[model samples]
Target chain A: NAGVTQTPKFRILKIGQSMTLQCAQDMNHNYMYWYRQDPGMGLKLIYYSVGAGITDKGEVPNGYNVSRSTTEDFPLRLELAAPSQTSVYFCASSGPGSNQPQHFGDGTRLSIL
Target chain B: TQLLEQSPQFLSIQEGENLTVYCNSSSVFSSLQWYRQEPGEGPVLLVTVVTGGEVKKLKRLTFQFGDARKDSSLHITAAQPGDTGLYLCAGGPGYSTLTFGKGTMLLVSP
Candidate 1:
């Protein structure tokens, strides 16, 4: 069903480089989120959007930015990639209800050297 | 910060054995979800429990929500090798964000 799709499955960047991770969903959900998973640590929210043109910072928002230009797309931007930014990034989408289960994308493995 | 604590960070058992995973939190949540993730893949939702003291069964898997909605449990009966994966529990406060547990890595060897 291609619920949630994320581009750039893997990437490597030098310190101070920049890149954008793409995410798109076909579920027509109203909420989208960006999260990073580090070794042994649980997923941490980076940014989220309620709907198109509505975005907000999450728990760990530093070094990352997100934009929700449409209901189907929410992209995450890295301004100046650092070693700490190396982690697996995941994109998730949910329906209108706040308690609805979130559908996650496969994730993007990012490496900063 | 609201946190979900999962017990037994790792589990390895033979096939046909039963196992249980627990997720606990001090803060109450409106709903909780269990997800199973394989290597190199995102987590897939296994089940969601909302009401307190609610029990939902999916085939050989059982999900239970605590009476106070602050804890949950996932029990697998006669687990098979296919069930081996990383299990995560997330609590939702009826909003956009969810607090996730570190996860339980299960290995059911055949």
Candidate 2:
């Protein structure tokens, strides 16, 4: 049902370059999140938005930016891509209910050289 | 830092065998969720155990939550080839963030 969709399944970037990771959901959920997973590590939150026009930094928000302009779209931006930023990025969305399950996107695999 | 520790970072077994993966933490959670992720795919929710000491079964898979809500386990009976994937457990302590485990990489041979 197009629960959560992320763009650019794979990407290679040069150091200091900037790019945006796009995420969209059709579930009409009010909560959206961005997370990154490193090799052999658990996912770390990058940013999150409770509703449109409201966003907050997460555990690992360094070198990342996010915007929630609409209920369905939340994009994560990397201002200066670094080698440490190379990882798999996931987008998730949930409803208003407490502890509701999050629907995850296919994830974006990005590498910086 | 709230962390979930998963036991035996990796596992390999043959079809028709049974295995169990564990997830443990020192903090009490309001609920826990299990997800299975295949190569190059996002994780799909397997089950959610909310109450302490709760157990649920889905086909060959069984999920159990600890009495203290600080631990959980996944048991697969008569495993099949399709069970090969990464299993992750996430704890939601009624917070906005969902903390996840390192994950168990299980390989079920045919």
Candidate 3:
């Protein structure tokens, strides 16, 4: 169904490099989120957007930025890659509701050396 | 900050075994969700419990929400190899955000 699609399923970056992770959803959900999952840890929110042109920082927003220029696309940017930033990135989207379940993409496995 | 604690961080059992994983929190939540994540994949929604003391069943899996809305449990009856995955619990505090537990890794061997 292509609910949420993430590009670059795997990527490797050198220290101090920069890159943008692409995420797009076809469900027309208003809520989009970016999360990083580390080994043996739970998913940590990096940023979120309630709708196009409206973005907010989540629990862990340092070293990252996000833009929601359109309802379907929300991209996360890393200005400078750090070793600590190496983790699997997940993009999720959910319809408007208090209890709507989030649909997630397969995820992008990122590594910084 | 609200935190969800999942017990039995790792579990290994043979086929036809029954096991239960737990998610506990001190803070009350408006809703709780269960997700299953396999290797190289993102978390997939398994179920969501909103009301207190609510119970939902999906085939061999049963989910329960505590009456106080601060805890939840997932019980699997006669688990199979295909059921092996990481089980995560997330609590919603009446917003779009969710506080997630570390998750329990389950491995079922046939």
User: What C-alpha lDDT, on a 0 to 100 scale, does residue B57 get in candidate 3?
Assistant: 100
How close is every model to the real structure, measured as TM-score? 0.98, 0.97, 0.98
Candidate 1: tens digits of C-alpha lDDT, residues A18-113: 999999999999999999999778789999998999999889999998888899999999998999999999999998654788999999999999
lDDT of 3 by residue, A30-110 (tens): 999999999889899899999999999989999999999999999999988999999999999997643789999999999
Q: Write the per-residue lDDT of candidate 1 for residues B1-110, one digit (tens) a residue.
A: 78899988999999999999999999999999999999999999999999999999999999999999999999999999999999999997886588899999999999
TM-score pick, better of 2 and 3: 3
- Computed on C-alphas against the true complex, the DockQ of each candidate is 0.74, 0.61, 0.72
User: Which segments of model 3 are wrong by more than 4 Å?
Assistant: none
How high is the CA lDDT of each candidate model? 0.94, 0.92, 0.94
How does chain B score by TM in each prediction? 0.98, 0.98, 0.99
Off by over 4 Å in 2: none
Name the lDDT of candidate 1: 0.94
TM-score of predicted model 3? 0.98
Model 3 chain A: weakest 10-residue lDDT segment is A93-102
